[model samples]
Target: MKNIILTLALLIPFSGFAQEFPNLKSTRQDEDYSFLKNDTINKNWYKTMKFLPINESKSAYFSFGGDIRFQYFYAKNENWGNGDQDKDGYVLSRYLFHSDLHVGKYFRAFVQLQSSVVGGRIDPSPVDANPLEVHQAFADFNFINEKSKKLILRAGRQELSYGSQRLVALRDGPNNRQSFDGLKLMTGKENMSADFFFTHYVAARDGIFDDKSNQDRQFWGSYFVLNKVPLLKNIDVYYLGYKRAKANFDDATGKEIRHSMGTRIWGKSGNWRYDGEAVYQFGDVAEKNISAWTTSINGGYRFNSIKFHPEIGFKTELIRGDKTKDDSKLQTFNPLFPRGAYFGLASVIGPSNLIDIHPSISFEITKNIDWIIDYDMFWRYSGNDGIYAPNTSLIYPGNTTTKKKIGNQLETEIVWEPNPFLYFRLEATWFQAKDYIKASGMGKNIFFTGITTQIRF
Candidate 1:
């Protein structure tokens, strides 16, 4: 009760300030560096702290930004699939400071430092803390500039995201989001763009300056997007490759090398929008052959003119699973570095070896407030394979009582964007355990609630 009042007190003032002070003006002519133009909620804060600018010029300029986020989470029956446990309440906070330097258009540098901490948890995990470390340190150099196209070479650690984030994502939902150490070559025109990279995932350690690239794994991929194609709205075609020295799955442990090829098509017409994606994987884990695939489709319609401006949508996914472990073939689909909140805000399940259907609706309560509700249902793709969590951990092994029903989840989220730099969100989720989870070990349903607030600058 005290936390709720304190949270409200902290958030209420930002709403008044947003109306009193418009966002600061950016010196740059283009919206590329504008603080309020990058994201849907306009939460970028790069230019908001203009009073602290070290130097400003046309050819060379330096700016800084910071973000602070706090979240309170409570979950009933925390680990339902494995066992029954309850975590009443916990608080998580993350702080980030970054510097963006640009020396003309051809050369630039970016560095970000993060400090993440968590407290009051029932069971604390490794993903919680890193006192301080460089989150992103990258140098961008453009080699070719054509009238309608440009080629840029970026080196060092950076962030990589593509498509709808069903597969590759930054994992921002966690206290310590994931980053990578890699080099990338990007080429693009006004309507087309492509990215090629070879990189390694960064491992977050508990202490400061201890984070480093994971030596056990490597990721390489090429992603291309075409926005001006005829009759295609927008198309994304990609090929991703992953290699790990050691991996275990399906009662087998060995070196794993997997490749995925996929395409995503999406667009909007009037009040209707649609997205479809499909991916196929083929590789080898030691001597075992790997064959897996996943598909996703979602569409939505919006009534912009109506009161509250509501939007309704539905989504479905099909991910392959192994039928039996008798053969030298493994069939569990792997979603590499997917978003932390893939299946709604609760994010209890990941898109691996499963089938799911989700329906959602959202509406704007005011110009600065919005609310969303969703109901998601899950099932195992192969009854013989059993259920797995988002991290590919075997929650229930194959033939776990011959139960295929995973569960159903109902979730709601409310977001308040007081201004471009300040935002608040509250989320609640109820997960009803089904045959598989209950049969395994679950004693009670799962109820989760999270309250979050962030100041981007």
Candidate 2:
């Protein structure tokens, strides 16, 4: 039955002619590419929405943009727990407004304001709620602009993300995106660059002007990207440091300081592509030595000659776990600021102290429509630790059981882009529990469904 379902999914996209869709890429392209990168509005979308039109004047050096989104989610047996309230539904709405101003050839300013709200019967978590706040505000100054070299300095509240977004990201899947209060410096040209930053995460509050940089935590990092590496598409290397005044975990709680260093290499040739990353961490938590690591690898192939331009890929990852409760050192890996949807649409699990194998396939139904299907299997790397949720919350403790096998998940998603300014998506997922969850009194099949729509102007 699974084979039949996958066969049909691979064929659905070839049923009709290819269509064109608007590009929805992020606004963080390299500065050397072009200053008008964000101002290049799509001509196929509504054009009359421009009010000031400074974007149309070559000398004006100012631009404005915004986005609106609506999302709804339904879940059955959330966290594999049994209860009437475990099955729930919720809806979220978000609005973002931003502006950019440039002065002469070296200075620029940017600001973004956002509002997010929740509706429906489900309990609202921190990710789903935040009303009216400054999402980002920053100033940029260029130190060099030669053909072969470039340097930039930026300061104030901003967004930060590194390679692959497995360990660091802006949290785009949630209603309220994440931000940081920081200073950053970038060096190098278009083909190679390095970023150095010092910052603290901005905590989202439910009220205006109440959002503040987390005083108890500090972060610093340097990331390098090499666009042209031999035998590969590119390479990434980074080092990050994190300190928290007080931290908590299954076996301990106290001040913590952690350092992480990692490298990633990825590339594509012909019809095949691949990505691999590994990281090691060391620190002190609760006066105990901390040591942990993680490794991930993913590869895929595209069938261009097939009807739908289908692609299939497999991913495997292993994260370290604490050796024993009596040990003085902690071993669970910590993904500091990972993407919101790191593990597919359901996002029920995090990359911490566990092992996972994921197989996925995607189809380009048309230029405007796409479909994706994923299956994942989970197991505890150390049966003595616990299972952590995508939010880094401890959902099941080690004392709950010594079982290793956790569960399996299946998910499907469809995305539609009618024009450059609008997009829609629908997704559904199911999870089947194994002995581990059942032993913890949280045994049950889980289901999740959601729909989202967004418009840019």
Candidate 3:
């Protein structure tokens, strides 16, 4: 079943390609060359000869470009539980490949594949195995004005970035990108722009889960932004609304739904850059009525080859339990919402289940080199009593019983760019927790590291 699904997915893009360039005839010499050479020539020949409009200006016609990346990671103490263990030492953590293809003045496409190994296993789930997965497959369209101003209309699985702090990022599509079947419209002028987007959910893949069950999920959201305000030169403002409905096969048997609204303001003055954001969420999870809020602030300064950024953030929530006694009515708080990576080291220590305060600094070492250092502090505001709680024995704590717990994390990374088309990155981290929150089903005082290389054209 998985093989059949994979075959179908692989053929879908080819089908689209065939429809888009059906009339082109191949002039390659050998049959084998036809297959291999066809892949490269089809795109180039189509763009140059077939797609170009006669009498069109060079800039008005079509253009093509793309990028690719490869990555690997090395880690120590790889035991992520679930009946798995990692010996203390070095290990190949990941192998990743990504590519992007742009078409005409308005269309773009991208795809990513990844594989990894840990604890001597050849294929592990994203949490434990080595596998190959596609990260993106999308297209974009741009609109132009008489004066050559820029406007854009994009659809398919595409990425989005907005807000001063990315608080309501429905797509979470960067570093590890998340895309959706959606549409986006935007317009921009010198140093000013606005954008709007709508998206429907899709499955997430990262070397985990069998392909059979990897069928796409469903979700939808809308985001908007107004940036580059003149009142505060170098400043921007953003607003976003996001909604996500649980997938059909989600683990939670009860209805799982979420809605988020947020706003952000940011700007730069001379060598200083400042930003802040706030968000509110309302929804039902596992049949539990839920409400939540979050906020963050950040500032930075730049000096020639060196740059520094520092940030802080927080989250709060209200939950209502099921009505029936047997259903176990309960309200829980999740601490990791606003800043999952608050402490650089903790992000590496274990899964960011919840509860944290984070701050960090990043620097540009040179034209092609850079570094970032960050720290995280954690505590439980409310939830089940056992591991995530301290100073209280209540089996099921309410919002009132929640208290501050303690944990800290540190992280650092170095990036190297050899040229416009090539680059490398390395990272390391350490974490420490004071109570069961860090040890229960999660790691404690753990360490991790990773590396990646990329090329573009």
In candidate 1, what are the lDDT values of residues 329-380, reduced to their tens digit?
Answer: 8898889888777776566777877889999999999999999999999888
- Cα lDDT of model 2 by residue, 1-457, tens digit: 2432443354344233113323334553222213333555643222222222345454335556677777778888877765556345877888888877766568778898889888775556667788889888999897885778889898999988888888889788888888889999989987899999999989887787689999787889999999978787799999999988877666667888999999999989999999999999999888689899999999999999999999999999998877788678999888888887778657777888889999999999998899999899999999898877665667778788888988999999999975566678999999999988889866988899998877665
Shift of residue 143 alpha carbon in model 2, Å: 1.4
The 10-residue segment of model 2 with minimum total lDDT is 43-52
CA deviation > 4 Å runs, candidate 2: 1-24, 28-60, 82-88, 146-148
Tell me which of candidates 1 and 3 scores higher on TM-score.
1
lDDT of 2 at 213: 97
* TM accuracy, model 1: 0.89
List TM-score per model, in order.
Answer: 0.89, 0.89, 0.61
Q: How much lDDT does each candidate structure score?
A: 0.78, 0.79, 0.43
- Give the per-residue lDDT digits (tens) of candidate 3, residues 1-457: 2432443344333333343433321111000111222334456543443233333333233223333333344445443222354443333333334444444455544454444444444444333343554434455565663233568776665544445323323221113333356677767765566776666544445435322221233334444445556655444444444333431111123444555566666777776766665655566666655455555566666564334432222222222112222233323222212222323322332111245556666666665677877766655433332222111112222233233353566778888864444456788876554554334444445567665544332
